[model samples]
Target: MRYHIGDLNPEELLDLYRAMLKPRMIEEKMLVLLRQGKISKWFSGIGQEAISVGVTQALREEEYILPMHRNLGVFTTRNVPLNRLFSQWQGKKSGFTQGRDRSFHFGTQEHRIVGMISHLGPQLGVADGIALADLLRRKRRVTAVFTGEGATSEGDFHEALNVASVWNLPVLFCIENNGYGLSTPTKEQYNCKDLVDRAKGYGMESRIIDGNNILEVYTKVNELCNAMRKRPRPILLEFKTFRMRGHEEASGTKYVPEKLMKKWAKKDPIANYEEFLLEKGILTEAIIDGYKNEISTEINSNLKLAFDEPAIDSNETKELNEVYQKFDYEYFEKSEDVENIRLVDAVSQGLEQSMERYNELIIMGQDIADYGGVFKITEGFTAKFGRSRVRNTPICESAIVSAAMGLSINGMKAVVEMQFADFVSSGFNPIVNYLAKVHYRWGQNADVVIRMPCGAGVGAGPFHSQTNEAWFTKTPGLKVVYPAFPDDAKGLLTTAINEPNPVLVFEHKGLYRSVYGDVPKNYYTIPFGEANLLRSGESLSIVTYGAAVHWALEILDKHPEIDADVLDLRTLQPLDVESVFRTVKKTGKLIIVQEDTLFGGIASDISAMVMENCFEFLDAPVQRVASLETPVPFAKNLEAKYLPKQRFEAALLELYAY
Candidate 1:
């Protein structure tokens, strides 16, 4: 509990010195390796070492810390092996990311570290989610997240702070004010006098500390941790510091004024701490040289081992086995206990069953609490799961998704709901770049699901009625499922919750109340990448998903003369290509339909696959019936023409006649 340098013993003071000194020594040597082309890139934390070291030392082992690229001292101080760190720098198989990414861009659960996304601001929200997990588990741990002064300008900064303050979660937001974003100064970044001053907008507690004084940082952060542990709350700490080196080794710091650099050189964190310890008789020249010699030998010997480690590459099956967490894709079972229900009720029952099964499962979205969301899918969730499990988030899509990632990092499953599928554009950065990429980058599975209410038949116009399932199907490391019937909706959504990786459940808004089917009362799952044979005929193959499936069914029942084999693709991402080809080969013709526009729809990809692989089996040319390349219109006649339903009959007849 004694945090002040004056109250510390000689050994404890030396520990602090060693923690700060090792990163400086390693990075100083990394400069030599960069010149020799041994490592491709390095982000220097030369003078800003105290922020990382002091923060790491002040927190408990279980408390997670999300770090930016420049926080190398956090890794070193935590005692992650020198060889593994160096292996990462060398793109070797033994690295933290298995050579998938370089630098401190990956996190290891072994160290309770969640590496920041390249965007630099989403980690703050992740910290909030980790803190939320601790609170739910009744643990006395506070989450720490770091960012540069430049990142405060991002909208995520506002969302993370506001959400933490609103919920009163235990989080310490450390802003390393290193004077530059890449080349831009703090003056050009924001109008605030200091970065901590921005915390007032969220009505949160804040402090300004001299980051160069390691003791001051350690002492103040330690006291704050003790306080937050007792009474959970969020605080913003602005660590006034400077980047003594360039952003990376390749970029020179010529843009920074020489006079300013000279002024900060005198305030070097390691030197400042060393001088105090020396005056107190806690350090000697021998101790300094002794640390340097010890660290140098460790770096050199480990560099050799790292050099010998094999450099991993894509498709190296033996080395890349853990890229993404494997799931039991065959979790589905048929049950005789059935009831007629709408698609929305089936979805609600599926969520309820998943919640009853897994206590760690959390559902979060705007107006999803007492209001029960706009679509009423989560009408009674808050009452059953409590506010902690069924949380109502601010209208912050990016932070909401990032917070789910944080929850996943803490070994919890999360389901984030976007009221309208069109709103996914706001959270695209984290969904595509972070959630979709983290597993492949670091092998950290994001066990999160995003419920997307999509489609265009409701006449909600372009913004609310956009079928954007195609956007996510192109992205890897994510499962995309769209169901037309209630049976498949409950089955696929339950499967999504059970999945270890991120899954997007595109629940068609039109089918929620309109479509009805016999769904099992008991819990069950439907395997992904499996197609349902809805109708069997030899005339032609009608392939579709979502609302278009119903339109195809309507056309077939009205005219029994047109015999067609209908294949309902439950999942678009894993896309049952085998079934598509089978149906194509059986009928010797095909027609792919979707609610989305025709230009760049998922139909084009399926058409290409059919032409490439199943061309010889086809008796006639393949055709695609889709909406025109335009936004959904509000007018009834225009919307009717914009959707694929009106053209389904003609396309099917043409394909059947061929």
Candidate 2:
């Protein structure tokens, strides 16, 4: 089924020709900007413009788009100001990322275009999640995800495609087969002749299109998008194209053979489409010239607007003051009348209550629905609300996190769980780069809660056992909560679920089944960044959280004469410096404790914060008590020795003596 330019109206043909010319001109200008020392670098989508421009044009304004770095054509066609692109290259305030993000890293919610991630293949999962959100809301919108052929090798690509196919999501996986991924040719990377064949492995319908033919690309994409909007099924479209320039501005074509480069360049998409338009009489030479002139004028006008646009002042305070900007005091107030309940039951009750309260809340994760999650936190969720609200995902951590981010962006509250916190590295990119930073980058908020089982007191060793709260403690836009008791866990988890940002709720392995104080049977939330002072004393401040919080309390009890002020950091990212300072002022000594390794752990951060913020009040050098720097040993004897039990107790005793 060969679609030709002759089948389209003169206006449509001219528009395609104009679209081809504009992106090329923009790419050429970007190179000039790079050479002139105005911009640091640039990535050219020169030969791949036809497919990007055409596919984006076929989709409606409300539909979502997630493009990789070499997608200037899609952004330009979607009405992203070219000047902002250039300014981003120039590291100016008027740039899309406000001088904070690198070139081609711009995204706008107003344009229905999600931010571009430089990392390959991560966006596939993000797009899948977006499609799922559209499916849940019954909205007639498709999510288009674009990436190079090389991205196909990433596990996230397979994960996203499989999930999207299984769920029948309205997502278009557009693979721009530019022949080469940087210096590596597709033949060298994969054995298949057609990239579309990989889609069959995931049980998805796919097509191979001549990406150089703008009319063919646009028509086929339009048909697929329309079909998806009707039934919400995933489709894979492999667009065959070429890269006219090197991988990036800094890359030299020394590795790429000149003969192959010339061969691909001879089949230039822009030139071929221009000839097709002229040969078919769909657009006259004069009409083509006029269209080019008109598009050029528009591009120039947008460039001027981008230049004249006010640069975002980096010196100004960030707008996210709820919890990320400063410590939230209201949620931290101590509850004198705390109820008694099992920690795991408290979590399950909180989730069940919240879902009942908010109709928009959706829960998803591996073994979450019928399996009730690994710890039975989501037990009976599917029975109560049905599968649509409580979904069980494939064992793809990247897809789970990305989908949560996408759903949150489109105005749905998502509570995504990880089977274990140790496996979070699989979805770390979306959690850190996309979900955590999207609100600050795109000037919008995403209300999503990611719950994971963390900490190592149980016998789960190595891969299954890890305290990873410190891994994300310094991430600027995310809220990291680690609750020690049943009441604190329930309250903080509820608060994180309701907060208008991506939040990581780390449930300690030791605390999940531990017997703890009762939780109130009512709707309540504990705010982030406020510490709970479990015990008050004048000798030293024992700062801790999660499982270690319980350990610290126990140690303080064993030695009542120690007189230590026990501070539980409910949230890690938004550290309560004021409270720590006040406690240190009263005690004049500090002891930081955690279940993780002492080196480069949460204890280090607490120690540094005390030294920097409360140095004047310190009477002795701040001490840190943490687990030994080794994988949690499998043997019970070694495990006990590897743990931070003695270190925490010794640190408290030493601080009291000081």
Top candidate when judged by TM-score against the true structure? 1
TM-score against native, each model? 0.98, 0.93
Report the alpha-carbon TM-score of model 2 versus the true structure. 0.93
Best by lDDT: 1
Model 2: per-residue Cα lDDT over 247-366, one tens digit each: 886776777778988888877877777776667766677876786677777767866776676655654444444224233434434446656788998899889988997898999888
Off by over 4 Å in 1: 1-6, 313-323, 330-332
lDDT of 1 by residue, 243-324 (tens): 9888887788999999999999999988878887788788899989999999999999999999887667666684345545
Name the runs in model 2 displaced over 4 angstroms. 1-7, 304-313, 316-339
lDDT of 2 at 128: 77
Candidate 1 whole-model C-alpha lDDT, 0 to 1 = 0.89
Candidate 2 Cα lDDT to native: 0.81
Kindly give the stretch of ten consecutive residues in candidate 1 with the minimal lDDT sum: 1-10
